[model samples]
Target: MSQHTLLIEVGTEELPPKALKSLSQAFSQSIVNSLTAQGLDVGAVTSFAAPRRLAVSIAKVPSATPLNEVEMWGPPAHIAFDKDGEPTKAGIAFAQKNGVDINALSVANDGKIDKVFVQIKQGGDAVAALLAPIVEQALAELPIPKRMRWGAKRVEFVRPVHWLVMLHGDQIVDGQVMGLQSGRNSRGHRFHCNEAVPIATADNYAAALEAAYVLADYDARQQRIVSQVEACANQLGGIAQMAPSLLDEVTALVEWPVALAGKFESRFLAVPAEALISSMGEHQKYFHLTDTNGALLPYFITVANLESKDPAQVIDGNERVIRPRLSDAAFFFETDKKVSLESQRERLKNIVFQAKLGTIFDKTERVAKLAKSIAERVNGNAEKAERAGILCKSDLVTNMVGEFDTMQGIAGYYYALNDGEDNEVAQALNEQYLPRFAGDQLPQTQTGTLLALADRLDTLVGIFGIGQQPTGSKDPFALRRASLGVLRLLVEKQLPLDLRELLEAAIAQHAALPAADGLTDTVLQYMLDRFRAWYEDAQIAPEIFMAVSAKDLSQPLDIDNRVKAVQAFAQLPEADALAAANKRVANILAKLDQQPSQGVNTALLKDDAERALAEAITQQKSTIAPLFANSHYTEVLSSLAGMQSTVDTFFDQVMVMADDIAVRNNRLALLAELRALFLDVADISLLVRAKA
Candidate 1:
């Protein structure tokens, strides 16, 4: 019953920062699953990650697993014994294979009749002995997207394994990984403190490493980096603008983080603040500083991997590396401005977006036409939309954009303004790529919103036209992102644009090819599937989307409104009962339709109950028809629910069929009308049933 703390660390040569967080999470989860599967009582598994190591500590872990018994099945009741009730060879063999005798077996009820079975007694094993191999197996199965082989056996891993620390309580749980053995020792601070540091237990891991000039806890290390960088910038009469993502990357890239301040030539600051900050953050992992007026300062702060004997030496080294990077950025920015924004439009003709499609220029032309068409339909300014579309892709040819690919759209706007282009045109150039990720900003200007939608729609139609649709995880062209972008624009902007017409016109612009290149119904279905996925992600009810989506999805905004109406209706008190009755009507009508029939004969009405149901439906249709035409789905479902009582009464009081064939046909026709009314809202049967 004794419990102990368990610690394991895998040391490696500097791992990619992007892979550290995920790798550590996977390592912790794998260890927890492995320990649980082995019947060990585990508690509080904590993980730590750095560029050189992945470590996990489990507190209050059981020292050994409890013994468990397993049941073994023998032959069937009748087959296990002969007519004289004697055991057969099959039963004896099963007992022997299970390490038991026939006399040890007994009959037990297995929720049916008594059956022949065996209960095997198992003994417990020490948890420490069991965890070594299990932990090794789990590490071997860890999912590291890309792995490499190093040294003699060339065992594969995300990076070459240099050492491993494994301990159970205060004892080393000895094991080997990739030709390296686990011990109580772990290396620290790659340069400043490279000697092996001994660890006693899981509780001592963080403090032990810290004493050796290493900070193993990622969050603590990141906090230190931020505070030091901010303090350094504050001393220079400015504040450091921290990038959370860049901070995370740098945090993972070092064990003993040392924040050092460095200065650059002030002339570099004259080359657009964005270009300067992008170079510093993107290329060097340095945090940029700005004065209170929001102007870039000449100083920046960076984290060093090691604490140097002379701190000034480290600062000078980082400055040397940053100077060339900033100089390259400045050159690209200044040379790019030499060409006017209007002149760059000509260069897009040579940039191929996709081989099957024409140049980037052709895409721009198509998007421009689609944008104007959309603007007119939405009552937006047509001139602004057209102008935005024309200049949106021009930035791809700019020198600064070529050097910093992430600044493609952004760099275009700055250069465009320098060339004296309209503010709207420059703004649209940047806004076209807005909302690149979920919850990111969308286009703020009307023209930019229109152009963004048009550009995405054109991409969806063109790629789908060529049959290069996204399948599973192989979305090479990011079509899924484009689809979500379109959905977000229409729904969030409350734009009154028709998605189906937009797709058709976008496809039509590229439709001068052979029949092999024509747009098929499959392409539109693919786009709708994307819409359904987006709707589900938004937490909307699936039945609502299924119901209204069956009618028309051309107008995405209208589809959204109808979905809201259906969701509200499904939550009503009478929704479930109405859906059940509607489903019954649907089933009966489906069976009747399968048989050949044209019209119902009124003379076949033989019972009062049947006659009453027929009259009720006719009157209800008169009231529901106008409501459906107005898209009052809530009112339509309400009236349909009111018919449930009459439907149930008719089913209970009268038989739908009579000896005469005409009578059955008339009854089926009446039920078909009831089904069609509910179908206008949704196939209500798909709605989830209410709990009693």
Candidate 2:
């Protein structure tokens, strides 16, 4: 076998900044997989992603794959031969299909019986002959959500393909890729080199690109951007908070990244820092700098694609462009503050929350009432919560929030503050949307927690009331997020709120026309179902959740407590025996027509084993009843675990179904009492299956 460095480059117009990294990585891995699948020698693959190209280089690859001997299945030996062992036409046809003589086939045991199989040595194709199609397949499989066709060519790609570089050692593995002929010429940075550079060998790809003033490696360019951004921010006596997404996007937009400091008017700082930061980071794609105390600085750092002769001109251009953006933000902020958020409440009537759900103002009214109820139940200020909810979405109509949509809730917070609302009320304006996505921060204040939970509950009930329950991933209204938000607030904040009562309150606030028949239960079940993924991530088995779910535990906080209790109980030494016994009791009860009249009569308790089990239950219930009342599920299970030996002994010694009807009924009642003890926390039968 011979080995050489293999380089593949797909040149294009500037790629999408957000998708460049994923595309490049996918392209590299796709090539590696294709080579490995063909039994070819593959080595460490390094990818290069610049604004204009995606390339991968392999340190070790073979010119051609080695010949392989593989078996080909044929008809069973018994079926292929006659009774005398003479070859039939089927045997000849099988050998002919494999291009082998009938006698060349051998009998091999395929585990169950012998079958006729042929072993053939097949040579591999040359790398040059295979690279073109593999490259084409790799491009065809790129994670491109949308593709465009440029020029008259009947080909589609993420961007227009300009050139390609496919080299094996010093030789060009010639083929057409994405309507471009393969070659060693790759264009450098548009502003720096602006000319095609010839790659002499596959091994010199990075060095050659760097010489042309292009940092082809994605990670190297990303690190360089970070270093420069931090240095510029340091010089300005602030730190640049480089968001990973923004950094990756900027890295994709530049070749030779040179971070330089720029500034806007200091007066713009009076505007909310969120507005200014969004203007710079979202609109201008610049990294904003903040001082040690977390105050916004007027300075920003912008990455230039090229090194300018003056460098000051580059800085001035970026600063000049940012000033207008910041000025617009300042104007929106000032204009928005002229009218208080309270006055904007009337505008919500013109906006629709959902077509059937009524106007936005209607939703706010419902959320206001529901939130106040929740606040009162949780010992928070009802009046303050209602006021905050009333004004929370008012920022949607504000000039500042309309201009900077990402700052909707934040602008409302500042506006509420300027309006002289209470501090918690003002904070709730923003806190309502605290967890905007996965793993985001939750509301820190009691008022915010109430508003977030109320708003989501209202939406869930209103939507599900209209029969728009989320179905099979088509959650256009983000119902899953709303559900998770409610669960998180209840569980993480340890709010002692009951979900059943909350859903009822929210459902009561819905318009009377929708006929919320079982809609409340539907919404609660959906919310509880979201708990499955949460507990699964915690390594709590599905049966544990089922155990808690079987009890109709609606309060997420309580449900979480019970789940933890069940999980802990499952590890007890008596768990398996008790769970199996619980399953047996359940089966026996399910098979009976009547439930053995609820309570065991003392006069009917004739068997000594049944009497002993009954006595143990009465004592354990006295201790566990208090524990279950206080939601001390773990302690209750621990106390009940002590009855396992007594339960097993009763089942072993006492015949539950004696010929006497009264004796059988009493035994049934005893078993029913035992089952109810475990059902206080969870359905132990579900635990049985989980342990299995």
Candidate 3:
């Protein structure tokens, strides 16, 4: 078959900026998968996404699909032939169904029976003829949450489908996709070039659009925006603060991006930089500039789609638009400063945190008490923790936060400092919400750490207590994130707090819960289970976590240490045999109707292997006891590795079950002691042998 580049373009109105890149990728992959399934070789697929279109250019695609041979079987020969060996109804029907003469069907004899079969070869269609359906199917599978219909027609998409372009080499692929016939004409920039631009060949699609003032490549356009914005910032002797999400949205908003710098009144800088940045970036889609000291520069960069003849006019218009936004932020800052966080907190009483769980005020009160309790345990100032927790959500009622919801905790920090609260208390008000997402920074101050823990715990226990536990698909309250945040604070921060104890403290704060039965255990298990995913992401083996989890540990830091120790132990040469030996000992003890004796009787020991193992266990126990106490599990396991040989020799030479009942029980007691020593760290028996 001849090889050619195939281009498919779906033109529409502006797509959702955040989803544009994903849509383009999904579209390209779907077509590539379909081509491969058709036995057509395809090469590097280039996907292009913009405000008005999503397109893919596939290189080195074949002109026609390859033939595929399929075999069909018919009824048995005994059923297909009459007594005289003439064709029966079944034989004739099979041939007719296969569109062949009855005599053309061949009989095959097998060990079991004889049957008639036909080998049919299919597929040899021109690749261009199949392009339309493939494109349509790909569009149907796009990850659009909702699709809307344009005009009166029943067809729907993310946006109204305007044109479909399917080009193979220099020829147009003839088919209708999304109710639009295939064409070489694609519309360019809606304002700059309000006309159809003809694509002469599949390879010329990107170049053709660029000439018409549309950069079809998403990455190239994004790069251009970044460069332009940086150059604008550099011209003002400042660095541009470009958030990735905002940059992508701006790239999606423009065709031929022209970044221009606009200035706001420097007086507005009196407001917090985060509030001003939020106003410019979140509301206006502007990139803010920061100075050498990393302070806001009262300037913003905006990407314009069309290149204006008088660029100064565009810059002036943007400046005019941003002035009022800054003014509002300034006003909110001033209005909120007059009210102390203590007074603002009273407003929270009216705000419902959850219908059944009382108001936000109630939550704050509970968190304050829990914070005090947790602070006492974690060596934090209980007074500061309680003070911070009470005012943590107070900013939610502030005017600045009402206007800029992203400034919730941050607004509280500024207000608390203004109110002459302690420095740590002010910092904790902001830090309580730190590490909001994965890989985010955790609270640094002890008071902040305790308050963050107390806040998350209260929500988790209260929510779970009310029978609103998160399911596999839904977690509206973000309990999963909260649970992970709790684990991260405990493990990463090296806090020695126990999750079960904290949950109990939090549960006590609640007056009544509909599903209070086992609430502490349920929430604790759910939070601990979050560690499984966390460790899995770290590439630690599931069995390593399972071995540690088998202990039902409630202390995250301790569990983390044990997990690490087990991981280190699994790498030891003796890990597998010791694990197997432990498994064997466990099975022996489990089958006994009575519990084994607490201590092994030396007089009953007969076998040399049993005596040697008994001596080894006693010595290792004394050596590792201090190590285990200090949480130096790695060293303890390494020390235990020395006893693996004695364990193997004992298991191989000494039978655990003895004919004399007393001797069997004594041997069982010795094995039990060995198992308990290993269990102190982790159930090493669950460790899977590393693959050779």
TM-scores, all candidates, are: 0.88, 0.92, 0.96
Model 2, residue 417: C-alpha shift (Å): 1.7
For candidate 3, the 10 contiguous residues with the lowest summed lDDT are: 683-692
Candidates 2 and 3 compared: the better one by lDDT is 3
Q: 1 or 2, which is superior by lDDT?
A: 2
Candidate order (lDDT): 3, 2, 1
Residue 38 local lDDT, model 3 = 91
Error of 2 at 669 (Å): 3.1
Candidate 2 weakest ten by summed lDDT: 511-520
- Give candidate 2's whole-model lDDT: 0.90
Give the Cα RMSD of candidate 3: 2.1
List model 2 lDDT by residue over 1-692, tens digit each.
Answer: 77999999999999999999999999999999999888887888999998889999998899997788989988899887788987788888998988998888899899989898999887677888899999999999999999999999889999999999999998999899877889999887787788999999999999999999999999999999999998888888998989999999999999999888888888888989998888898888899988899888889889988888998998898888988888888888888888988898889999998999999889999999999999889788999999988987899998887888989889989989989999999999899986888699999898998999989989888888888887896998999999999999999999988898999999888767375888777888899999999888889899999988998877889999999998999999999999999999999999999887788898888868788898999999899888889989999999999998899988899888889988888889889999999987899888878766
Q: Give the TM-score of candidate 2.
A: 0.92
Residue 461 of model 3: what lDDT? 91
- True-vs-predicted CA distance for residue 395, candidate 3, Å: 0.9
Best by TM-score: 3
Off by over 4 Å in 3: 70-116, 689-692
